[model samples]
Target chain A: MQMSPGSRKTLLRQVPTVVWVLLGMILFFARFAPAFFTLKNAVNLLTQGSILMILCMGVIVVKITGGIELSVGAVMTLAGMVMAWALAYAKLPIPVALLLSLIVGGLCGLLNGFFVTKMDIPSFIATLGTQGIAAGISLGMNNGNVIWGLPASIGYLGNGTFLHLPVPMWLSVLAFLCSFTLLNFTPFGVYVYALGGNEQALVLTGKPAWWYKTLVYVYAGLMAGLAAIVITGRNMCAQPTVGLGMEFEAFSAVVLGGSFAAGRGTAIGTVIGVLFILILRNGLNVMGIPTYIQLAIIGPVLIGAIVLSVLVEGGAQK
Target chain B: MTLKSFLLRFSRLLALVLLSMVVAVLNPNFLKISNLINIVRQASPQIIISAGMTIVLLTGGIDLSIGSVVTLASIIAGYVLTQTKLHWSIAIVSALGSGLLCGLVSGILVAKVKLPSAIATYGMLWVGRGLAFAIMGAFPYFGFPNAFRYIGRGILLGIPVPIWIMVAVALVVYLFLKYTTLGKSIYAVGANPYAAKASGLRVDRILIYTYMLSGLLAALGGIILTARLNAVDQDIGAPFLLPAIASPVMGGTSMTGGRGGIGGTIIGTLIMTVLVNAMNLLRISSLWQQFAIGLVVVLAVWLDMWIKKKTA
Candidate 1:
């Protein structure tokens, strides 16, 4: 018997839910085998997942605008280093340093947006160029040294607990809520999805899509800046390599959440995706798998996610 | 060629000459034959890989996985030489074969599976790098035979053997693109894939062939790199990724596809090699090298766009 189109669409929509169930079962089994199912461990996983979730949110916004930003990780590093330099070297107030880092991150995003919109460069190439520049700047800032001894107030964002939960977890939740509101409630958010859906149609309506496109990148950069803050606070140090490989992780999470490369992704789905990755990594760590081997596993998982999304979405469209 | 095309093709060369003169003034050693040969030798791997990258870019695709493929290919060769009793020549062929397999996978994903080139190749990049790291446990592979080492370091006709290999590969690529039916098809496909398909061109086959060729050249580069260092490591090919891409882009190859050639890539490679060499001689910190590269990439693309706009 053939399935009806309506049924098929409903079934495709359930794919993420089914995957989440399977992931839960895996965690359940893993708890038994490796004794990794503790409440504390679960909370730890959420805490670690928070930074990635923030970064993934940014990526989702950019992806929704039909643009890719490969430089977010590098921007995160530079922002963190700048924050570290401000606090440690300049002896600035914590709030001032935080603002400085955010500004730097926003400016980097602005540069990326300018290249893509004004210079007519591809998003990937433009961001890759920025990636190198940001990374180089991070390296040059402290000559590749790690800055430690951050004040307790600064560490509060990453390490402090509120009502028995990590600050980063709360921050991530707040960020996700804000993003959901921005994406679903505002006209600018509507424009973002429209920009991805059919840019020319929006242009035909006499709207300036370029500014909206640029705004998405700026939002992404801001998220990265926030991530850098949490990362530095948690470690109590800022290093040139702190955010290395994070862009891939963010990309993987966003894509795994069923966001199409061409645009159309939800912030909630990204949260699920980030949790799945964190649980998988935590489980692997518990099982004593080497980091490199874990990396190997993530590669196939990312490809599988892409293949699944393509097939399911293609079926839905048909 | 018309004057416009000539200018477009030689602009990089002109930049190279101008930069060289400035560097020579700053450091007299820059003009020495030894330093010049060293620059060419150092740029051999870039020239080789960029030759392949030019084809990929020409087809409006990318192969970010080439860097990881280089590492994996070299590791495979290293494994064959150290773990097994295979002959050196066999090990070398197997390395190239591994790269070919990778390229085939990327091609199938892109051409048949209909995935975007960036996502598909980025996935391949992770897989390749992961395999390289997993296989060697993140350790460097050493202990190559002297004969294998000769391929990377030995001099031939007063020049490095790798440089000779690079030239030979570039010549073959030049001939292939200029004279072959398949070569012309690549340009057609990149120029407009839908139109090319409607016109009876085998677009998928062209894409697969181009990616395979890119993979093959990247593998060749890995082998030369392995031989030069007399060891294989995960990080060896990491630095080459940007340069591989930047060389072609700087050489006037359009990232959007169908507007550049190997001739431009060679000049682009020379320009990059000279820039880095000059930076070293000037005692600039190594940390700033990436900054320089990033700036060059952005400026080069901006200049290309400006020129296109003006001519139009």
Candidate 2:
């Protein structure tokens, strides 16, 4: 609460950079390819952005709690694979299958929470360990096989459109609203920020710091679980390799959205982060930029954003 | 002493020894001369890369670009061998030079431009990977020089040259870190950059040198990797990023910086090699191996923290 106005101004200015990058990407696509800016293209953007947005939101929460979880990608893979395994091999009801996947995902997070809290392990290492656990279980259950032949019900969640938006996109919006409400309007959110800003101080307050801290891990797990659902729906199968390295992408988006990894973040910022990254990728695809070049451009864009944040912060403080 | 701290120092080595025993027991041929030599050869590049990475991590900085930088070096060497037919020496130097440039760029960003090493090196990772892809356009270079093959395959005093070279390189690094003021400064910067700066140690220079060293060592890895494969491709260094950090961090280096050394890192690297050998022999399934590494990374880091807490 005692953060300087200068810092606030700096953070605000950094926020617009993401918007501009998104705007620039949209226009870049529109100018280069007419089809890139169409309603269909917008829908495509949303569908892709939904999964990433969810993952980033999860990451944002963890970061705000002053913890970084690198295992969300592996957790997503686990969730999706379990859901597919239930439906395909066990022939379970799709709803039951879906519930199982979410439960497994949350359990993965809870495992992460347990290790980090009870074991006195740092978040990064603890998650990395559990990430392997999730990946192992997901792969072992399927025996290195891709779980295909998804049921129609689950596929609908991935492919169906609701009022011109993909179902997953709708889910993303719902997730955003829910996450935002919890983060911005709840005491838990306050505690998370305070935890990130000053963990020792929070500890001194005799607040249930470990509970709130571990809750963020659970929060991440839940969001990743939701991401798994969307991703599974889209792929129509669970490939064991479904979510490797997606965690880094989420990290980049979170940073781009002006959510400091040192704590102080927002679901709103994470959503913007997801949107911006997808837009840039879509724009590159539409423009026929070689994949390599597109990937190359990402570096400069990311570095530029960071530099801008620092510079804007310096200027505002000055 | 706390139980955690006590274990941090011994668990990794114990794990290494246990893995070796398992591998050797499962396949009596595990520690055979040729296999042992092969393991050392395979590990040489990674050991060199870790040497550089240790310094960066010691300074409380992470470099995500080492893998991409290796790829870049591979392509550069590939381009040289394919395009010019340069003598082995020239080609090797150019490849290392290219990697050094990448390190310098990363260093400048982190040290001079004041960017977080994680974010900055991450930028370099994408850029470097992209550039590698752009250079080769999906084609890999083949028909490495016969001399190049010698660099990787040639034996010296009953051991592979890469192994000997790695030992020599590690000795130099170990000595430098243990005895040199520059090495001390690298640790100092990581331990407390503000304090180091206040003490009038050139923190920026020290960091820049550390990254430069990392780049060079990664290229050394690339050169050997290319020679071993006898081919260079854009994707040559893809699997290195995680393993590189996993071994060092797992060896009890604090991720928060300012602790650890070539000793633990080399042992850690050897341990990884041994574990991989075990899994391959056990046919534990690739899924389990990946999971195991991930799990071990967390365990090692946590073990280190717990031990530090217990002792302190």
Best prediction by lDDT: 1
Residue pairs in steric clash, candidate 2? Answer: B4-B307, B5-B307
The worst-scoring run of ten residues by lDDT in candidate 1 chain A lies at A309-318
Number of clashes in model 2? 2
lDDT of 1 by residue, A76-133 (tens): 9999999999999899999999998889889999999999999987787788889989
DockQ of each: 0.59, 0.57
TM-score of each: 0.94, 0.94
TM-score of chain A of each: 0.91, 0.91
lDDT of 1 by residue, B1-312 (tens): 977776655667877788899999999999999999999999998899889889999998888888989988999999988888889999899999989998999998889888777778888888888888888886778989999999999998899999899999999998999899999888888899999999999898889989899999999999999999998878877777777888888788888788789988988888878888999999989898888878777877777777677666
- Candidate 2 displacement at residue B6 in angstroms: 8.6
Q: Each model's number of backbone clashes?
A: 0, 2
For model 2, how does the per-residue alpha-carbon lDDT over B140-239 read when each residue is reduced to its tens digit? 8898878888877788888888898899989999899889999999889989999999999999889889999999999998888888789887778867
Residue B58 CA error for candidate 1 (Å)?
A: 1.6
